[model samples]
Target chain A: MGPALEVKDLCRGFGSRRAIENLGFSLGHGEILGLVGPSGAGKTVTLRILSGILEGTSGTASICGISVASGNRKIYEHFGSVAENHPLPGHLNPFEYLQLRACLKKVRDGRREATCALQACGLLRYGKRYRIGQLSHGHRQLVALADAILGRPSLLLLDGLEPRQLPAVLGELPIRPAVLVSGRNAAEMADFCQKTIFLDRGRVVVDEKREQRN
Target chain B: MFNFFALLTYEWRRISRTSDFFSAGGLFLLLSGLLFLFALLCYVGKPQTVSPFAFWLGHGWPMVLLLVPPLSADSIAGERSAGTLDGLLCASPAAVLLAKFSALLLHYLLLWTVALALQPLALFLASLRLPFPLWSGAELFGALSLLPLSGALYLSCGLFFSTIARTQAQAMAATFVLLFGLLFGPSVLLRFLPACRWPILEDILVRLGAASQNGWPDRFLNFGTVAFYLTATGTILCLSAVFLRSRPFH
Candidate 1:
């Protein structure tokens, strides 16, 4: 079977400023990969490209053999992403936002999926009727976690989350999809990922593999 | 599409809860009420001269159009600015844009329809048949039929700019400029372009101007003009979809 995610020679730019340059990487079906970099080091851009949120200027990315270049709805079926600064509609209550996400992903039973994910994330303690904007930042992050975890997607992309929150976020996942995380903290990446790629100036500077320290 | 309808539901709730809608509708009704009262004072026993129907036809559409720019200026642009639009990428841009267009258009129509019904209430109290006359089937149907298309056209114009603009305020400003330009530009432009006053050119410009469109009663009844507005509405909506799809992900 093909890798859960396959990125080859990916290049992205904003006018004269190149954000990512000729980057390539892949994540196997069960492995969790972490992208570690300082700010402006292209970690977020790389994750965006892999998730099909941003169009790469050159080269290709695919999830489960579906190309991001196609920009087709089919490519999103196996994927889910929780972007940094993702605007969870502030006016929508937690349940409403989850239901909206569930519906957007077209899960068979949106309410059930939304409820299950919310319960798994322990967010129901916050009250489903509370507006997302009224929730604490950590609680809001849980809302996003619930959104990504609902459909049990095959590939999950998470960007800019706090290092300490990783274990809590991952523990709520009902299905262990191939997870890719982008963060500025190397120590966190080292602790969580089976493999970690350190990027600087849009290119990978280090690729490290570590056995699980069980 | 499932996405469109789901988005439609979400948008409907957002629109209802946000409550700027009721404020706009209340403002509209207040102005209409003032117009009726002023008509009663200025043209008393001269109902033939300033019938409520004719008076409303003159000011109603412009009032509705005035609300259009601000109401839609934020539709997509606000979502984009708020970072909410990034989460919506899974749904096709067409579905998202169409849902915004439909939801706003429906909200406006319901508000205006209630206002339309009120004209008769005011008329009944004053003993006048000059309401947009729900009594006459053909006349009422003729008057009401074009409202949705016109509302769609107005909302689509705002939605297009909202998607294309960077901020909600900028979107609203652009929509107002474009709307007023289309409405009153020709007469004003003709003054500055006196040197190029060719009859055929002037005639075409005038045909495209508010002289033919701002007169709501006659314009709505004219099949050609209605078709033109509907076509323009469709064209603008298609352009909105394209602009939405082309928006860069930050």
Candidate 2:
């Protein structure tokens, strides 16, 4: 009914050094947004704040009209996140890892959901055969991606990942969710995302909307 | 509730996979085995010195001191260092901490259970009439019942250290220090104070020393000690959750 995500006047600082400042943005269902910035542009910090991992120094972030600052457990049910350098347990195979993720997210029928997520990621075979630690870097990213999509959350926040063709994957879902991905490649993300927000030193330098791509 | 159980199971599996788990388990088993052997030798060679079971029971506190920190030192700090804490905080921090604490406590208890399983070997040895009885059923029951009660506080304390420390080594060191302080500080203070002027203080210190030492008098459970451990464990666990939730990434 409302936008899937909203942030207003958000500011986070480590003492006097601000990681993100006066950040404001919104995303609607089925829309894809790109957060493009330099190393210290606050892209990851913005994503982390939205995902409830870090407490913002000031302002509000809400998911599906629920404030992230409320510290409500129910807010987590509305979103799934892939963090920068997502850590996968080396001991668990990909399939088992997904099952564990599904379980943590309180997905009903975790096994079935894990199976479907693996299949959707096109890693069902490989995931079953090998531990996540043994997988290539690219494969691990896919596994993390699969985990984010497991519960069909209303909002998906991915940090430090290239969303080159993530739309292709999100398109197949029964109800496409709002996705905000952070990365360094501005041109590629501009071409890929419906809306691209370029951050510099924790401020939005540019927020552009491309003509809707078919 | 669902989150707690899910996270608990995941935590258990995750901790068991670490090399530290195996190393700690090995150390525990080795120490427990040696204690059993020594007790058996003491019984067969010189029955008048001390009962084999009493000797075994007397040594449990040292094993607990040596084992708990290693098991729990990395429970939270390792996740933060590896950058996994962000992913886990997607769940409630309370659930995550509770699950980690539960898993660590379970692992700690499981280790003691394995070590105590050796008690049977001594029992079997005593059956050959080589010495007096190893341990009475009541004595065994008392030790078994109090093991978790006494050990939970240490594990929770370790988890608190893990939550606050930035690395596994720091957590381990902090836990060992805190445990050592709790274990010996009272006795050290008691020795320095004049007994006539501080009789009440001495009495309280004596109780604390016994409580921290996991002392089992007459092989019976002490309800006051049980209450103290449980309350301290719960308080430390709550503090751990609070620290985890408030932990900022600068």
Candidate 3:
């Protein structure tokens, strides 16, 4: 019943330098929000904190009403994440990699879900044929995207993917989840997102809704 | 439960498939085979002399000392460097650490088994009937019984280093340094520092020495030593899991 994602006064700092300062946002179910920022603007940091990969210095973030900082393994089941510049296991093909993800997510019929995820990414042929390391950079991004969308998670956190890939990704989802994607290209993100939040120097510069843009 | 087993299987598959493992394992087997050949050649002249099997067992620890670091180093540090650690954190760090540790321990045991098998194969090829005194059943039992215990301690230490280090190479180097120090440092210190005439220090040094542990393969049972290995291994594994859970990165 609450927002699918909610962050209030979230702050993350590395010693003296703040990565994100007083960051706050909320997204409802099935709404797609874009997080557009320049490099070092804390977009990735925000996503990492929400995904429970990193701890915040202050404040709170929750996904589907579960606190991200709770250290509860169950929190992971409600959402899926694609980390920026994170590497996939090169020894595994796409199907195998996704199978591992499925196993971690505890998706019933893991093999079938993995196959379907690859098919959704339009990578069924390549996923079967090549190891993830052997794929092109673009394909690897797609594979990472596909990984995030498995299990039909309630919230999806996608970071650092190319803007051009958004259409193919959004078109393939059977039922859209609450998506928060970060990228540098604001114009392209605006096309796919109902709201776009622009960040600079770890502070929100603008929070534009569809009505405001209209 | 499913997550743990799946991770364990994945670690097993990946570790076994590594080309570095194959190449290092091949070199180990080849060198061990040569050592067996030399022992066999030496055996023909004197039936009353030290057995080739005993000699082979004496030299086994140094080979294991070198082999385990490279294997275990790549578990956590390699995952971190490859940037997969974030994705894997979905599972509890304890599960991930346990899975990786089990896979590496199994691989370590397999390599030793293969190396030990060379003894019988060489004997069969030589077709030489040796005197009963040359084969020591007690020594074989001692080595086999203690292998898993010692392997757990060493591999856990290596895994701990991997969890702390930023890169695979750094993990390998740190583990190698720590292992060599733990196994050999006391003996080296005792040899150099004649001023250490205190009885307790002498006893501790002697107990901690590689010469003493290698000598364990000849002795049947040492419960204190077994307890020491198991306790130390468990502590290191716990620390590894803790470090992995509270990973500090910029």
Mind giving the per-residue lDDT tens digits that candidate 3 earns over A1-214?
9999999999999889999999999999999899998899999999989988789999999998899988887887889887776578878889988999899888889898888888888999997799888898888988988888888888989898876776676677787789899999889999888999999989999999988999
Q: Count the backbone clashes (under 3 Å) in each candidate.
A: 0, 0, 0
Model 1 regions lying over 4 Å from their true place: A168-174, A212-214, B19-21, B39-54, B119-141, B184-226, B248-250
lDDT of each: 0.76, 0.79, 0.81
> Better model by DockQ, 2 or 3?
3
- In candidate 2, which residue pairs get closer than 3 Å at backbone N, Cα or C atoms, i.e. clash? none
Evaluation by lDDT, superior candidate among 2 and 3: 3
Model 2, residue B119: displacement in angstroms? 5.3
In terms of lDDT, which candidate is strongest? 3
TM-score attained by chain A of model 1? 0.93
- Model 2's chain B yields a TM-score of 0.80
Writing each residue's lDDT as its tens digit, candidate 2 over A1-214 gives 9999999999999888999989999999988899999999999889888887778999999999999888776776788788776777776788888887887777889898888888877798987799887898878888888898998899999887777648667876788889899999988888778999999999999988997433
- Stretches > 4 Å off in candidate 2: A212-214, B38-54, B119-137, B186-208, B211-219, B248-250
DockQ of each: 0.64, 0.53, 0.62
All candidates in order of TM-score, best leading: 3, 2, 1
lDDT of 3 by residue, B187-250 (tens): 6877776675686676556545533333434333477667767887989999989998887563
What does DockQ come to for candidate 3? 0.62
TM-score of each: 0.85, 0.87, 0.88
